[model samples]
Target: MSSDESQQRRGSYVPIDFTPEVSKQCLKQVEFYFSEFNFPYDKFLRMTAEKNDGWVPIGTIATFNRMKKFRPVEKVVEALRTSKILAVSEDGENVKRIEPLDLEGTKNARHERNKRTVAVMNFPHENVTNMTELQEKMEEFFGKLAQINQVRLRRERGRKFNGTVIVEFKDLPECEKFLKTYSGEDAETLSFEGRKLDVFTKKQFDLQREATRGKNFSGSGQKARSFTGHRKNMPQQEQKDENKEEQKEETSKEEETKVEDKD
Candidate 1:
């Protein structure tokens, strides 16, 4: 195989060619970075935009962790030049969404989004290290199943991929259809990259998580109860000491009451 193919298989971010297709992909990536689905959650981007009237320097964007593969500011700037929803600075030094962020619209949209989201697990996490590549792969794989709004890779400590993802479909019907096709009885047969996958609706995922948490909490409570039981079973000498202390405290109170009455 050629070096380019080797690099592609390795999930290398380096662009092999600046073809129109690559440029189109770049446009989508850059647009999504500024999209409502991603913008609100990207703290650094939001803060940088806030400082410059929603205009983020293209160079700065090129330095973003996820944008590493879209490297060389010039390529990103060139790709975004033809974007309809994004505005490229006259000098091409910066980029910004043409339409102002609609916070209220995003808030309203999230409710419906949650209803159409599903959690998937058992991904071949070790095979792909770059989150962007994994996300794209997930989008392509599930794209064949339904119309997806987005695929979010779930991460664990140190920003590592945790072999799970949440896919949000465009609508409830498509979401339900995908779940019916891949989950429950068919889950064992469902595989991604040769690894069996488990799929659950957002509600089902939440309930499972809550149930797991309850079990953990119950275990801790049992340990606490056992500790109390151990204290109750303390030696006779220790019990006598505690009883004596209580009696002395009651006697002191009684004497104080008598003194107050005498006064």
Candidate 2:
């Protein structure tokens, strides 16, 4: 093979995926540094590649070294220095901020503090007419539960006084333990707005959404109303029967009018 062809064959290589252009740029900067300092090209390439994350290509180093022959070594060094490839200080003492943590005697601090909490029982049957009544009931119910922390009452628009009370606990673990012990059992029976209080956790409330999927409907099943399975165009059986009855009534009235005219 010809020398040029052999060199081309040797240079033909796979491209590195990570910041290939940056690697080439860095290699060029390193070549400039070595030429300015009169260091060996082979040693510089090896050291630079080894210090980097193993993604620098051999062809890049060779090309950078070849370019240094035409480029002024001083100008190359100045460009390399400005390019941020080489350290400004050899000892790297100026870059002492990049050091491992000295967590030998450090204590891990808690992100959250624990406190007493109350679980407000939701009663669907209660005729809660207003916020005042709802808040009163919550206060009364939470008073009965032991280790009651703080209760905040909240109401949503269009909802008739039915809302949630957020209870903060001294610790999350305490609240979790309380939920575990009294989750399924009746903790306290309190009468609020003429309804019985039902205690539950926030976790249980979230789980209920998955449990009742596809079962909820818009109207009662007694009437032919638009709901889960029925489409708007496809009227229910009851609606069809109602329409037929109305048509029969209209036809009878028309026949009666015709007989009266004939008589």
Candidate 3:
């Protein structure tokens, strides 16, 4: 093989799942940084995330690197985001503000400090066994999680509330009890009461909720870029869904602010 070809095959290879052109280009750049300059990929990823307000859009990332678009570089980025070395400075959207989980130095300490909330994904909208079965199960599911500040399981008439349950614990130790018994990977799905549920911190849920708004992740004072890296047309129905959620969120905030002002 040629020298350049040999480099492509060296310490890094493009993923087969990506489109050939995009993957090849991404790998070429990463190989240059990793092998030629010996630049650390993790630091680059952290910078990318910081630039885009804690969420790195694959296409935007390419633009920042002066590379081409049409490349789904998120898979390659996944390597960096999943790295243990990076630090998260702030949060943005689900795709934003991931600093909640991406903090560099004390990921464990930060996670421990995030005792305020726990996310339960793929939870039943309503327990079939009993109308209030979910609430009852929650009370006993974890020995102490039952003593939470509040439980939010949002649902619409026909649509499930993403089947996610955000539970706020009463204190740090209570959360530690829950985490020690069930925590896995970031937002790992755990089995509970005959149902499979993805679990994450309240902070992670904040990231997800922020991403749901369909807002641009560009940092303050920066122009927002299209979120879909490949510029694929987002379905009309999906767009409408995001708008509805955003509207509800805004209305809730406005009312809360009004009440606070009244107080």
Candidate 4:
């Protein structure tokens, strides 16, 4: 394309000031956004990857509402360069996982993730404008309190932030430490943004949710089954191997039709 054409294409783009802090946050957000734990239920990203053999354009990733603030597309691509889980394309225009996603493995991942996660509620939802912002704000808040892996904001059917979040820590010890210090008797006095907080272990959260919604509340697990091929529980060894082969074949087909985006 001509220089004028290229300039016109990017005319509407407004770049943000990139700094070390912005870079760190960008990498953290993108890494978790594509991590095995979040990818399965990430419908939009899954769709985009399916179109290009798991390779998603950096431009596309930068378009995400949360990532938009980390602007100048080059900065987004640069931050991903050091990622241990993501790999940039040879042409440096797109990015994908370093290895094909192990769909079956996500079952065990979710189990492990739950082991070190805690549910934090009553966050003053009216202050949360979007899920991305909520994740950022919560991550910052929780990071100061403990070593954390990710903070997922629970949302309602209409995509409204419900003032509840499930926070996963880097390890069981950190998780337990946070819970022991903040929950039970201490929870009464602990407040966030001036509002009292409700903290619960994963088990407690599930029980409370079930109690309020009745015994049939399956949560997002049931919803995630579609992407996971309904393997809610572990499968036989032979079946698992067979599914891996099938997944490989599907990925191969997607790669065969890979199309590079001009933008």
Best by TM-score: 4
Instruction: Give residue 204's error in model 4 in angstroms.
Output: 1.7
How close is each model in CA RMSD to the real structure? 20.0, 31.2, 23.1, 9.8
Model 4 Cα lDDT, one tens digit per residue, 97-185:
88777766774466577779887767777655555555566778989999987676665544556666778899999998888888765
Task: Give per-residue CA lDDT, model 3, range 88-153, as digits (tens).
Answer: 223311233322442433323433434566766655545343323454355456434346644544
Give the lDDT of residue 206 in candidate 1. Answer: 44
Clash list (residue pairs), candidate 1: none
Give candidate 2's error at residue 213 in angstroms: 8.0
Ranking by TM-score: 4, 1, 3, 2
Q: For residues 62-139, could you state the per-residue lDDT of candidate 1 as single tens digits?
A: 655556667555777889999999999999998999998886577556657778988776676654566656666777
The regions of model 1 sitting more than 4 angstroms off are 1-16, 126-128, 185-188, 210-263
- TM-scores of the candidates in the order shown: 0.69, 0.29, 0.33, 0.70
- Segments of candidate 3 deviating more than 4 angstroms: 1-115, 126-131, 143-147, 157-162, 186-189, 214-263
For each of the candidates, give the backbone clash count: 0, 9, 10, 0
User: What lDDT score is found at residue 140 in candidate 3?
Assistant: 55
Candidate 2: clashing residue pairs, number: 9
- Give the lDDT of residue 18 in candidate 4: 73
Every candidate's lDDT: 0.65, 0.37, 0.43, 0.65
Which parts of model 2 have CA positions greater than 4 angstroms off?
Answer: 1-119, 124-126, 154-157, 173-181, 185-196, 210-263
Cα lDDT of candidate 1 equals: 0.65
